[model samples]
Target chain A: MKRYTVTIGDITHVVDLQPLNDAEHYRVWVDGQVYDVALSEAPDHEPQVHPHPSTEAIPSASPAAARDRPADTATEPADLRAPMPGVILEVNVEPGAEVQRGDQVLVLEAMKMKNAIRSPRSGIVAEVLVRPGQSVNYDEPLLRYRQG
Target chain B: MNLLDTLLAGLLSLSWGQVVMMGIGGLLIYLAIAKEYEPVLLLPIGAGAILANLPLSPLVGDDGLLTILYNAGVGNEMFPLLIFVGIGAMTDFGPLLEQPHMLLMGAAGQFGIFGTLFLALLLGFDINEAASIGIIGAIDGPTSIYVSNQLAPHLLGPIAVVAYSYMSLVPIIQPPIMRALVSRRQRLIRMPYSQRPVSRRTRILFPIIVTAVVGLLVPMAIPLIGMLMLGNLMKEAGVVERLVGASSNEIANAVTLFLGLAIGATMRAEAFLRPQTLLILLLGIFAFGLDTAAGLVFARLLRWVVRGPLNPLIGAAGISAFPMAARVVQRVAQEEDFENFLLMHAMGANTAGQIASVVAGGVVLALFAAR
Candidate 1:
């Protein structure tokens, strides 16, 4: 059995597929509900193994060596997404600006109608990814925010 | 004494039918002012009805201003076409472009026009007359006038009034049918919004291409579609802002006043009180309901094939009431789910309905002319 995830609209569901003896029929479970889906292509299941030897034998004697490890990061990045596709007529917030919920962040012009994009939550603006007069695709991130 | 007695006797000779018509006119005025249903049109219509029905009013006589306005605009098919220019300028085709598939819904909605035509034919109207009456189902005023002017001029006044009246009632009439046809689950389906930016070049090319394609296919549609596309072209070209503004605002308002009054004046008691006029009204409602049902059913079929959030109610906005029907769809969707915003998608289908109604009008003319 193999598992896959599918997202439709805004809802996500995990699906499981089990191969049947007939080779054409696959038993699929979507969000715990089973469905019969046919396979149109052969499944690929081979896993590739890396052949590099370990390099941990070289020991470091420096006192600050433990602090140089890369995997101990604590902060999660903020996600900022565009509400609709349109030319970014203006960006009202800049990096490090503290914003409250419902603050106007950008203006999007679609179908000749101007729409003001507002902040979903309060935070400090961390980065602005677009500029004025730039056309943006739907759902493209226009800016990111982090805790002040 | 002899001359004064004769004049008084003439004034008293007015019939009860005319008096009743005057009262109906007053009622129309009240509805226009108090109820505020299409005040731009209904006010003038009500006023004209009152003036024309007065015992000795000269407003509807051969040389009167009302009659002259009628001859200048309605008789020559000038007002409706000019109004089309305004409609063309005001409409935005972005929604329709985002979902080209919704064009089919517009086509399905037009079943109302044909369905009403068939029913009118069965009710003893000749083919030409039936076509004009049937066009009232399009829920479009210009198309109604255009087709009726070409096919059956006599039915124009009643059909236009019926079409506009039913369009105003779309919010009331459409909800029941929409509720009955769609389930709660269907209404709650939230479609993810996906759209590609339509280039300015494409926007400029659209009106020209549509004019050529539709006009070549149905030459009879040239006047209605031609004027309509011309207005749209002016707006989209970006250089004719003045023309677009004038056509959408000044010309449209002026023509609406004249068109409404002219249509109202035609409702003289003797001409409008016939059983046939009542039948036209009833059939008009049937046509609108049928159009809405057809669009809903078609949308359901599309839903089966496509996995997304498409509210079936948006299909009902596929009539030519423009943003009004679209707004009604948004309201209905909000009732079902407060956060669901179906306005953009519904506007797309609504604009398609406007164009489709014009094509359907042309098709009707071509079909009749061929026979």
Candidate 2:
């Protein structure tokens, strides 16, 4: 479940969306009221709304989201963690560096293959805990963040 | 005079074929040592090939060591079955268990095996040999060995080398096809790892149930799946650390040497340098690319309908290369949008491919065993 503060005009609503079996359907709570929603690709003129009111998907209350925002830009904590065990090949982000979701923050070498760990959200890096050539374990936190 | 003549015979009896094969052996060793490609198996295989091709080498006759290992393990398919246990103990099905629907993509990955078989038949290979060559697309070395040795023992040398080499080349082979087939938007799609934890009881029962079910469905696969699940059962059972350690580490290491050497011994110039070997090599890469393509197309079809969290990149990993295929998929996705993490989802598809490939191998045997 993800919580989003959605604003339409002057009225702001706190909405929580929970996915059902598929990405299209969701059980959502809007300002404490619950509704079941199913999302589908809409024709050009139609709005992208589903089980919840078409008001929210992006986690932040700010208007940084776009009209073309993807449905999966689900809010997550800004801090990034190593997805698997590996050695840090490089660090691309430092504390106070502004980053977008999907920006490569570091490269990790695992099983002789290199993987880049990307920022989970558009946030300011608070701290980087690892350095190049340092071996790390699975789920070990690699970075801390302040939300953008 | 006879004793002096016999001593000089070894120096005089060199053939162009033996010389060429020895060079090939050197290449294999260079690949293993310098390129770091599946060294544990390839190094022994390279050495065995060199030993087998030595002028009047004693290690390759009826009473010879290499021949003995070949007869004992590879000829009868003992080594592959043993290796399957090791592979099972090493694989963790947690991600696959977390998401079960990925099995469909796994099934889709086998289309290449059949596709290659048809192409090989058209190119004049007998049906059984074609099937053995096709199994290289399965991308699991031991299964490739088991199926090929069972179906076309003569083709085992080329098939083994091709399978291992292509398995190593997966990252390169898959990315272009994946990029071509899946759109950028689809590649950038995110699939967070599922949080649902599989229960300990479910983990333990998983191997047992899979063995019984897969065994009954394709009884010929019983040998492959049974041993695989047995090793999996040991790992999940939690009471068999010693057993799991031996199966996954020491025993696997030992059998890999015997298997590699035995397989290499079969690569006598007379066997390994056929025109058909070239065809098998071509068909192996073709089949691998086809499997990746088929998987991507299948997943795209799924996304068209269900429409959520279905990253087509995960489809590329729907092959038996295990975590390697999955890792490649993850890397590709991250290349497009660093924030999108598809590793867990790709792993689900990869592990599914592993099981499906084994089952497909059994199906092949069941169909052609009578021939």
Candidate 3:
């Protein structure tokens, strides 16, 4: 397992990449939450790992993340949250679907307008948490991503 | 027997002109009921027209219900202003605030207003009357009524009707123009949604700043913009829930009914049935079309100038028909590319269009008032 810190915009994320069967799929830890990610292509550069500066360690288990995950270790995954309260109008992807950043994953109808919810990063969809016509609230788990 | 004869005298006194006006009222009622075109306003207007046209009807005579309502609100221009308060309460300016450049699209959309004004002039309409007729291009019902009521009171009925009827027909009227103006390649241009957080402080200050800026620049617009901003202030303040509720629902509904009835009451056959009315109707549609085209062309120019891709369809939302024009733009763009989502961006232009239309109305008033 190799840990790398990534920053986009103003938010910083610490991602731990664990190679599963091969270099193509990785078990990624964001903050303390685990996500299975499928790489669209092999990495050209090696991941840079650094020692924990402080004596305090990363939280052993993120309670919210652990509580939401099912007990199956084989299917440990990550989820996307709803941006706002709305009804799911369309789910554009299914399990095992590959998407790039900015690709629409689903559509949420809010304020009588349809808003496209996009993929935050390039990855494969592992599971869809909601179906069309289902009502969802702000920050509700929408779907999960996995590395192939 | 004497009392019955006296009561029946009203029915016996009906004129052919009044009967024709009643038939026109029926047509409006049918359009409202069957076609669902601005039914809230049209239905009340239709019923008022019939009531006023009745021989010796108490509803339209001195101190009668329609006359009283007209004098109390419509004639004095209170009803439309009250309706603006409701509109302001309901409107969300966040979209426009996030994308301030959409203000240009809003300004471009008013091109039709001026273009139609010139045409009305060529058609031999006096400057004041033509200006009132041109306001229909704004696609804003309350603004149209407010401007026409001030500049050309006699033209109010037809102008209000044309403005609203075309507004309801936006779905039908805009698509063809939108399709023809831009190539398919341009239509498929994708504009992804990007969320920009607007702070509460900014939201609270928006209405106040707009009121001062617009009020100073166009003093004629103060009454309309002032009431609209007042409602918006109450909503954003979050302390006046009851006021917001009443303004958006109860007061709006009440004023709409009064305004519609008063305007309809003015449509006695002798007043409404004229070649000028027909010309006004034609010119109204022309103004609407010109606005749509101008907005599209301006957006096309923007796409060339701006670095990012902007679906020109968003420009069509600049016609100030509120959510309807914006929705039509979204639907048209989606037809070409289902993955494309321009709703938030289109709404930005739409809200900008609303502001621009109000400003344009004030300008028209200013120009005519100058003389």
- Candidate lDDT scores, in order, read 0.76, 0.82, 0.82
Model 3 sits at an interface RMSD, in angstroms, of 12.5
Error at A142, model 2, angstroms: 6.2
Clashing pairs in 3: A36-A146, A36-A147, A37-A146, A37-A147, A38-A147, A38-A148
Best by TM-score: 2
RMSD (Cα, Å) for all candidates, in order, is 11.5, 9.5, 10.8
Which residue pairs show collisions in model 1? B191-B309
lDDT for residue B371 in candidate 1, whole number 0-100:
58
Question: lDDT by residue for model 2 over B1-371, one digit each (tens)?
Answer: 88987988877798888888889888889999999888888888889989999889999988999999999999899999999999899888887898889888899988899999999999999999989988887888998999999899889999998998888889889999999998765675655443466899999999999999999899999999999999999999999999999999999999999999988888889998889989998999999999999999999988867634578888888899988899999878767555555777788899899999999999989988779
- Tell me how each candidate scores on DockQ against the true complex: 0.08, 0.12, 0.05
In terms of lDDT, model 3 sits at 0.82
Best of the two (1, 3) by TM-score? 3
| Model 1 CA deviation exceeding 4 Å by range | A1-148, B6-10, B307-309, B369-371
TM-score, cand. 2 vs. native: 0.81
- Which digits, one per residue and each the tens of the lDDT, describe model 3 over residues B1-371? 88998979987788988998888888889999999998999888888889999898888889899999999998888999999999999988888888899999999999999999999999999999999999998889999998998899999988988898889899999999999998776776655345677888888899999989999999998888899889988998899999999999999999999988998898888878889999999999999999999999999989878765577888899978998888899889767544445677888899899988999888888889676
Residue B365 deviation, candidate 2, in Å? 0.4
Of 1 and 3, which scores higher on DockQ?
A: 1
Best by lDDT: 2
iRMS, all models: 11.1, 10.5, 12.5
Candidate 3: docking tier: incorrect
Better of 2 and 3 by TM-score: 2
